[model samples]
Target: GAGVSQSPSNKVTEKGKDVELRCDPISGHTALYWYRQSLGQGLEFLIYFQGNSAPDKSGLPSDRFSAERTGGSVSTLTIQRTQQEDSAVYLCASSLGTSGGQETQYFGPGTRLLVL
Candidate 1:
C-alpha cells in the first residue's frame, strides 16, 4: 500500500455488538501502533508492535479490546460488547520498523466507530 489503509471509515453499532476494524499499513514498514481518540481527547496509545512482536500492552482499555498484527503489515482491532463509551476514532500507524533507531510513525485516516 502507498499509505495506511483502513476499512469501513465509519461504523455504527449497538451497545452490545462486536466490531472488527482492519488496517493495511505501508509496505515494508514494520512498526505498527493502535490509538484511540475520543470526541475531546488526545490520541491514547493502545498497543504497539514491531514486526509481529508486541512489546507494549500498556494502553488497552479493558478485556473487551484486543488487537494483533501479522506478517509485520496488516492489523486488526476487535472490540467485544461495545459500549457507548467506546464511541471514538481508532487510528493505526506504521513506521519503517521500530527499534532503538526508529523515530516516528505514519498515521492512517482512522476508523470512526459509533456505538449507540
Candidate 2:
C-alpha cells in the first residue's frame, strides 16, 4: 500500500556484534533488492529477490551478509560479526516487475549502521 519501510532507521554497534535490518516492500511489488552505501561511495548491490524465483546473492561482500524475503513481502538483511568496515546505509528497493526495459527501483530512506 505504501512505499518501502525500514525499521531502526539508525543503528550503532560495537565491532564483532551482529545486526539485523528489516524492510517492508510496497504491496503487490514482486521484485526487491538490498544495497549498501558507504560514506561517499556508490551503492553496492547486496541481494535481490524476484517473485518465486531464486534470489541473487552474488553481490554480498562476504559470508557474514545474508538476506531473505518472506511470502514475497517483508525482507531482512543480517550481518554477523560485524566489522567497522561494514558500517554503511543499507537500502531496500522494490519494483512491480523486472522483465521489461528500464524498471525503476524505488528506494527507502535506508538504515544507517555504524560499527564502533
| Strongest candidate by lDDT | 2
Sequence-dependent TM-score of model 2: 0.95
Instruction: Please give the lDDT score at residue 4 for candidate 2.
Output: 90
Clashing pairs in 1: none
> Whole-model lDDT, candidate 2?
0.93
lDDT of candidate 2 over 1-116, digit per residue (tens): 58999988999999999999999998888999999999999999999999988999999999999998888899999999999999999999999875633888989999999999
- What local distance difference test score does each model get? 0.89, 0.93
Clashing pairs in 2: none
lDDT of 1 by residue, 3-68 (tens): 998988999999999999999988888788899999989999998888856558789999999988
> What value does the lDDT take at residue 82 in candidate 1?
99
TM-score of each: 0.93, 0.95
Candidate whose TM-score is highest: 2
lDDT for 95 in candidate 1 is 84
